[model samples]
Target: MRLLLCFLLLLATTLPARAEVAGEMAAALREQGLTGAVWALVTPEGVATGAAGLADAGTGAAMRPDHRVQMGSVTKTVLATGVLRLVTLGHLSLDQPLADILPTVAIDNPWAATHPLRLRHLLDHTSGLDDARLWQVFSRRPVADTPLMQGIARDGQALRLRWPPGQRFSYSNTGYTLLGMVVEAVTGERYEAWLDRAFLTPLGMRDSTFGFVTQTGPGADPRLAMGHFDDGSTQAAIPWFTRPAGQFTTSAADMARLAQFLMGDGMIDGVPFIASDLLRTMGRQTGTAAARAGLPIGYALGLQIRDRHGVVGLCHSGNIVGYRAMLCLYPDQGKAFFISVNADSETASYPALDAILIRALSLPPVTPLPTAADPERAKWQGIYTPLPNRFDQFAYLDGLTATVMVMAVPDGLLLTNMQRPDRMLLPLGNGLFRQQDRTIASHVFMEDADGVSFSDGGQSYQRVPAWRFWLGWLSVGAGLLGLGWLLLIGLWRLVLGPRSLGGMVSISALLALMLPAPFLIWGQSFLALGDATVGSVLLAVVTGLLPIALLATLFLDRRRTGLLPWLDRLASLATLQWLTVLAVAGLLPFRLWG
Candidate 1:
């Protein structure tokens, strides 16, 4: 009788704890105005799954724990696992050069003879390849049946290396797409089919799929959650060219299984699926300058070492058009959590939920242990500018805005930028540095053949002389002032004097330069610029004619004599100088579409 009473008391307490957690999850969805959400929590005891809100907001169908949602780039973790499986089976090697594997693919690497592009480099995002271009990501054309090589060939420029492979880290969807091609070449089968049979099935994720799933398809499940925008409008799934990079649909229950596998010792059903050492390598970075300098935190293979609320975890986040998801595994604590929301609302409080979940799991906070400051920190102090942006099209704008100044302070080093709040980095010996409240080393300074450089894993920056930095900003300021002066003078002259040939040509040039401004300001979407639409074509034409019109004005109005004319001449000169800088930066005649 006493034992029965104890068991009844335990059940009573557990049920309400679960109910309280469910209430918190529902309130989180309501606060964000989200259509639906699914989540899973994995602890040493067991896995718990929950759902909140509507699966189909229009149909009023309630979301179920089994309903599948797009996992986006979290697919990379599965792809990397499969690659590691192939390595263990002796079918592939991580250090194998891409030139040996795919001889026909056009990979332009200047340092290929020495530092070859290897499989591990692609997996770790140190391949030096650019991310997908605009058309590659936003194309409306159907790619469901397109061959991997054919899709890659459409944007061949993305394959060119910006630097030597294995030198640094830069995220590249193109690189992973190439890895999918490698899987096809080595296994003699479609990547989707192979991964489905070898990976998803073995892990007991029976409800998950490796390819695109559409609404009301022959094989589509009615339980598939509808993706939503901030206004609760539904969005249909579109076929992506880079399927292997980010195109898996999975349920919360299935994600729990995957999370369990990540937290386990590489065994499935008491059989060794992959070696424990190999699994450990999946979360560690190697062969990069930062890694060589004893900085171990970065994008390792597919997982990112993230510090959330002073607790370090192996984490990955994914986002498609209207769906967003995050997975975090704290292996040391035997705890993991996965959360997905149907709506891509910026106001969604992901961090709030993360904190709540952490507290619920009783995960311990990481203690900060600051080491002595590096005596050689003075060489690392200066203004540094970002290099080799992930997208070449945005390089010019990023160059102007992403510069950071590193200063040696009494405690450690200070990182200051105009665009973001200041960060204080504590020394961690051997040129590694981390924030005061974080456990992982988040910054590193290194010297190479090119020069001294600093990296935060994803982006790298090079030190520049102070004069060059000031001169670049000065040129930009002068150009803007000159353009404004010319616009005001041209309008005043038109109102005051007869419209002469010189006046008209000068005005035309000024207007030609400023025509793209409205499109930039009032443009509906950046995705529209990816294709050959009417607006994109107009932008391309105007930018192409900018230099020619400016040169013509300079020649046609050279002989005009007056204060306004001379000032116009000077303004035009300054504009021309700025245009020259743009030309050197390869942004002239800016064409958004292929």
Candidate 2:
């Protein structure tokens, strides 16, 4: 009894220090522009939990530690757990073909080219399934008749797979939605109902529930955090059908319980929720590189598996309407953190918040060291070809010039001369750079007196510099387009004076052709890069830009030639005729083509 008392006393004293550190971390976050509740739970034997920030901004109500917010796609982790539970029961196998489970739902693809998509493919997002424009279809449709599979099938029917099953990684929300359908088909119960029976009830996640609240009934918990838009306005509730992907509401305490259960050696209150080996398998690498963390990021079942500072991490992020949530567990440390906010202000950087959580846990900081320069930067310099839709390439000229026009990257900066404010060079080591903080990582040119290598994040990427091969081709295309525009402008001047109606009509025709031509042929490939897309879109918007000015000059101006009204009418007729010809000739199809 004396020994037990001493141990308890030691543990009690140690815990407050952890809490002190965690509290300081939270205070630092509040000091930044980011405002949201944070919950961190660390346990050696049991859980120590903490929460901070407002649950309601309007009322200034303090966020409850146990209040539920949308858990986002972290719901996928739970769904994957349920599926794995079934796998243990011998009811399903990871290799089971989708056609075997759902004969009616045809996953549209050329059937003969490869092996049919299996459960592993779906969970890993290597199923080669296309992403759905969920907001476009779901928000517009009646929720009842629009089944998950059908909604996916409709949108997916048209999209071509970038790769075959298990070939590479492509994050598809539609893939998980299909998993939800499989869950229902096998269990003969709705996905949420099965989860409730098999997982939630057993785990004692009492505050968590599926579907959006249609009403705040009597005695409802006032601590329920409201989701906020980037503009700080409250978001409307999403329909329930999308619940499996990210539609469930969960409290931070309940989410911590989940983290504990997952990190708790696969047990819940002394009972096994899942076998220890299966839990590890769920956290093992199942796919090619995932996007965010910049590596061959593993995905198993539904959760992302990553290793940071020697600790294995099981994590996911949830974003729906206005709500943003993230759950990360450092399983080796027996520590986990969950964050939920009523609103994520436009200025919020959730990943940075997660980084702070790591610091709060006293984990090793990702200290980026400035390595010495390599002598081969000039060898890597040139108009390296860029992969279509994958990367942007720029030739770095000088270090100081690169730093001034180029955003300061750690090693070097990504140099995007594109006009948008968001586009800039990001640094990679030894002077090579790549697009940083982007969805798809791209190559960068290094003029560090050392050669260039493909880079993402702070490390060198394994793939060869794709930008070098494709960028040359693109430059050629752009040069040709520029020469054509200049030639047209010169020809118009020689053929008719600048004030002539024919010259104006010809200029309008040239502008119409020039505006969309570059984007249709070239810019669409780079649209995935947000800043680059904005720059490209603005450059290509001549149709939206110049036509109105040309028309106003024709109609509103009082100075008129004797033939000017007739010529103006002729030009209008010509414009209509050109549009009619374009519609009938299927020239509009080029807009949809890559």
Candidate 3:
């Protein structure tokens, strides 16, 4: 009888808001080049849903309420809730050391003895694991969580923690993936199955599903929504084995129920899935990353805690390849909203829709920025990055961009990126600096060797000697000049004529060898790096000639005169210098053979 009632409720369009917002959002999504999207708003009274656009933009097929979209990292909320439920039952503990819980999975903590990874760290995105990597988990076919977990253990020995556990937040999908394995270990059931039994059934969510999903052809699974590209082409969903990190798919109505259950006591049909106490713990601030940095943002379990005037809003957003999702909860008002789009468009209408609904229906409007001046703000000026020694080769550029420069303005402090000087950050600050935007970014300064190190939320950066940047700029100059000189010589030979084919062979061969390199990097992200293609073969050839490329140039042009000699010298010098940079950046040393 209960199941029947829930099923009917899931299908029945309860309120008029469905047709209204659906039309509004669908029209808006089309303007943004999105094929389709669904939005669900929940209140203490009940749930209302709206959707618009098409499931298949190419085929012009209208989207239905039943269409499922990928949740991406939004899967974390469900996974964390499951883990917390176990904690409520005394089967798990939030503070329990992860190394102790999953003794079989190999995770090395350089701060092992003192600051080991705790269960809460996994939920809060602070398990010290490397954030994300672009690699596929298949050869013949997609595998199970156990084997993938084992690979994380085996290959992850070299991947160090980005920061000490609980020191701050650095969003890590690897940590969540390991947590999925922990669920398998604890309940003796796969993540997908356990989630069904725990939250889905009780909360009356029937359409949601998980695990690696693959489609051989377009519209292979019509029940599942295809991710639409900006060009109106659809991408068949691939098998994503990182189930815990992502791989969740659900309907908007079901997602709203999940959001409602999160802000509540976790009770359904007068039974508590997890105790009210534990549910409260999920909302309580675990780390002081935001508070200490004077940011309004706070993270509790898998949820990002935000501020609206004085009301607290628990939220999370997910974006992977083709889909985007945002879920916001206003506990004070007992209201929440979930918005997701099938197409990845920059001009998506969800953000504007969110603000409109959040203001008129949910929480009070946010407080406006104050006009106050601080003269002593000069004390906070410095360059800062993600704490000390957190940079690894795998995420070198990400680490470099984390660097921020603090400049004192007449009214307040301005934060700027050294790598992107054009960008400016106007932050709110009284004593500690904070962002006035929807995000909870905070900036704090601490004592350093030369000056103060600036910490933005979880990432810390220290002021380095200006010469370091000057050296990098010089390297860039040498690389560009050399490449241009060779290009000019190539054009001259093609049209004006080369004295010998020898000059053309060496220069062109060298260029051809390195041609596949950038493609390898792009393929690693777009496709799979290990996927053997013609480009991969050329990349291997480049790596084989890594040391000998410069040597051959010296031999070929050693006796030459005029521009040929300098061109060879400069191009070879640039190649060597660029190779050195890549090596230092950890972008080098990929599989060069087979």
Clashes of 1: 0
Model 2 per-residue lDDT tens digits across residues 459-524: 222223446435434544453454354335536565675555444544555555556546545655
RMSD of each: 2.8, 10.1, 5.0
Using lDDT as the measure, which candidate wins?
1
Lowest-sum lDDT 10-residue window in model 1? 520-529
Task: Give the lDDT ranking, best first.
Answer: 1, 3, 2
Ten-residue stretch with the least lDDT total in model 3: 133-142
Tens digits of per-residue lDDT for model 1, 232-351:
878767777777888888888888898889778889889888777777877678778877877768787788888878788888888887788888899988889887778777767667
Q: Tell me model 2's lDDT, rounded to 2 decimals.
A: 0.55
Candidate 2: residue 279 lDDT (0-100): 80
TM-scores of the candidates are 0.92, 0.65, 0.85
TM-score comparison, 2 vs 3, better candidate = 3
Evaluate all candidate structures by whole-model CA lDDT and list the values in order. 0.79, 0.55, 0.66
Error of 1 at 74 (Å): 1.2
lDDT of 1 at 467: 88
